[model samples]
Target chain A: MKKGIILVLVIVGLLVTTSFASVEKPVMGISLISYYNPFFLALRDGAKEALDEIGGTLLESDSQQDVAKQLAAIESFISRGVDVILLNAVDSEGVIPAVELANEAGIPVVTVDNDASGGDVEALVASDNVLAGKLCGEYLVEKLKNEDGVPAGNVVVLDALPVTGVLNRLQGFYSVIQEYPQIRIVSTQNAQGNRTDGFEVMENILLANSNIDAVFAINDPSALGALEAIDAAGRQDEMFIVSVDGAKEAMEAIKNGTSFEMTAAQLPTLIGKIGVETAMKVLNGEEVDRFIPVDVFSVTPENVDEFLEMATF
Target chain B: MNPFVSFLYKNKVTVAFVIIFIFFAIFIPNFLSLNNLMSVGKQIAVNGIIATGMTFVIITGGIDLSVGSLLAVAGVFCAMLVKSGVNSIVVILLTIGLGILIGLTNGLVITKLKIAPFITTLAMLSILRAFALGMSGGRSVSGLGDTFRFIGRGEIFSIPFPLFIMIVVFIIFGFILAQTKFGTHVYAIGENEDTSNILGLKVDKNKIIVYCISGGLAALASIIQTARLNSGQPLTGEGAELDAIAAVVIGGTDLNGGYGRIIGTVFGVAIMGMLTNGLILLNISFYYQLAVKGLVILFAVGVSRKK
Candidate 1:
């Protein structure tokens, strides 16, 4: 009984120190997609950075890439009396029940990076993934025009989730790549955004195809996976590798010459910071923009050293 | 006539292996090359190590679905420690200890709780998987030390270190399965648990030991896998339990328990290793590989049923 009382007092103390004029105590729940990805780790780091700035605690849960667990984490947050909740959903459509449950608990919800397909979220902050993809496609086009003078060759693509934001990025990248008359994709596979599988699947690809010109990975992990497999096959110098998601590790890969070409960077840290900031506004009885657009740019060997931290998008 | 059937039944694994070999050699040139065989052995090392422990448990009529999950946990822990700049020796010992805990838990759950090994290990499968995934924050613990990676990728006189480990584990397990009184107790329990119990075989104790052994072996697989990839991606061993069990069954273990052979599971593991590399070399589609794997499992089980 004493411990419980002390915990409650500590909770009250955390809430009373809010940056905004003294107001009702608030708590926030952070439920994220697969935490194994460094991208999500950066997202969590950003959220912690925000918590430090805003006097709130984060109850973080990983969905292990499962939609059901993502929902359960949200419901858990609601039951814990958090004033606000942030979601990085694995499946955007399947989170309605938990979102509605949080709303009933009088806690507003913000969707970060991954948009909630059906949830009535207070705010959604993420990169313009389409533009990010477009940027990669544009970069590839320029590379082909300047170096090769043509876009005719064998290419392998590793697409991310078959849904939503990732699908949007794929579509945008595909839309641009289609303009190249001679560029042909010899093979495309799914690694589910996991590095190990990416490595294995890419190994199989490398074994089967000896004449590949380039590889397009959906994210930095997959790109790195391809690079590892290529390195294993002793073909690191032969194939050009490009990807989205300029994560810090991927930038390091670029700087080290392990990875070829570039990545379309997404600011995971900024997403975390702004998602929390927007949640605070909603908590303060103020309306915030539903969709906040963050900038996306290409990171290559030329600028990787100077932009490693920012690469953790 | 019955002798012929029995003979065919007794050497089913060998027959299947031969058949696959003949088919691959005929269809794909260079399929039987020495380099390819080395690659196959190296590939089989992962599941071969896991199967060593599993054979012990199966000999006692028990199952271990948590083997794959335990592998993931051990790999993740070992990798995380290494990446955090911990000494390699400490990281290796810590990983081995974690494996022991997983095995101990499996044993306690089965023996103390008197739970069916199937369901108990099955639940463990999901739990340990979830726990490992959570611990790593769902990220890959990468950038391991080169010497640490040597266990998986190192070669001893042109032989992959992992394959070498698999052979050593097999020799050790083979000794236990063939020589020790515990081996006899395990087979006795599998053959007739009630009879073994009445015979003062300490059936429950034997059962617990087998589970622990299985966990330890699974951890060994994780070590090899981690060394191979040089990173402990939390999700690395997903769906691998099915492969381990499949290899055990394919090698000629009775699913209903009572009999298991370490050499048999090695052949089973070898066959699987051959299949993956074979298919990749032949450039078979992913869908075909999945179908062929299922068909192979069915064939192995069907052959075992004839016994």
Candidate 2:
């Protein structure tokens, strides 16, 4: 009779342990490619905030701008038995091994902004980067018209390279400016979307092209670079500048008159937050849409105050 | 006064630096202005401090390519801890510890693993750069407290804190070089490693120390860089080693190693900083500026090349 009582207690203990384990929140793994650029920083914060609200733990790793490191981060996530994984791939095709490992572990994977193609992630949460580019070009076309005067004169482009940001932004420029044949594109150089490099490259263009009427940069960093080059050349008032990525610094530039024109603002934090939320939904056995493309808006001096107050540098 | 003038005669480049400073003061708008002067002085603190440590390694006839990448890596780890509510000083200490470990690895890999310093450091460079970028998801670590930024942007008695740190670093390292036995060994090794080894110099140990110094200095640089920008850029200090090497070489260090001084590099780096500032003022294009920088380094090295 004593042995029977002991068995009963043991079974009860086992049942309690199993139930408590199930009651614990599911864990998620997230890998970020860098924290140097402000856009990704916002995304990191947004994702962290969302994960906190849902009671899910986030296992964060930084790839530090290396493809191999990104792959390692994913592998580390899988080994720890995370329920789901979020990846911001450094290179589009280099993340397959980690993605495959997660797939084998029966863990769902959601790719964040800047996807790793050919990997079967459950969903991709990213900005409509291409469409955002279109908006930028459209904005530029509208801004460059001088009292119904056609957009004309030599133009310079501070383009991003070998990526969606540059390609889409280029499309945006072409979309609106193609109609204005007189707006000649004098030069397009890859500044890699960096402010410091942007200044240097733009300085070269300014020296070579004396009649530049406008500049189209792929991102805010490049736009700021152009502003520096212009200022350095003592030609700040002669140019109309437009770019993408409405980072907080760009707003300051707009306010201070250091940089002229507009930026297509990508929803960096929103995409990050929604990505975490959607990943949770998937973990709960609910269906999430295959793609979430965040929208962007043109930020100008007219509405700059609101964004300035709301933005984080 | 005669001794001072003769001392100035010995370092013609440093004299030239002073002359240029005076020229800018007279000709350039806001050249001697407190803010502009502070900017250049502040910029030097990170590079100069790190270069001071690097001077030891270069004098010992070895090169360290991993300083830039290591800086980013160490910065990321420390910044991560800070964001998670760790005490800043504790984080800094832990980071210094991590830096020492990296430095030890560099020393071991070159001395024990039989890897050439160039190849070993180059590999570390690539690996560390990737590791830094991946750790932070290509984002920057931001919203660091004021105390941290103070290291980069603060001032002591109207002088930038970065400059203050840099001057202190120079004096400390300079004293070691001019007075310490270890400093003598460093020069002896660089001047003739095989002979020094035969003479019973603990070549392996000194090698390790030199690299350790390099790594620790790199950590210091990243910390200042993070404080200055108020964020740790996983991509911070990219291609920075080139500039450092140029400084050392143009300051009259023999590429064959063991024949340079920290003070010489100080002048070399100052020349670079001055040139950059000057070109910016001169409306030089970025591409042209790059060309000019390259040319100046080439010219300086050419002029200083042992005939």
A257-290: candidate 1 lDDT, tens digit per residue = 7746798888888888888888888888997888
Model number with the top DockQ: 2
Complex DockQ per candidate: 0.01, 0.02
Q: Pick the candidate with the highest TM-score.
A: 1
Residue pairs in clash, model 1: A35-B137, A35-B138, A36-B137, A36-B138, A36-B139, A266-A313, A268-A313
Q: How far is candidate 1 from the true structure (C-alpha RMSD, Å)?
A: 23.9
Residue A225, candidate 1: Cα error in Å is 30
Q: DockQ (C-alpha) of model 1?
A: 0.01
Q: Whole-model lDDT, candidate 1?
A: 0.77
Every candidate's chain B TM-score: 0.95, 0.93
Candidate 1 off by > 4 Å: A1-313, B2-6
Clashes of 2: 25
Tell me the lDDT of model 2 at A204: 91
TM-score of candidate 2 on Cα atoms, chains taken together: 0.53
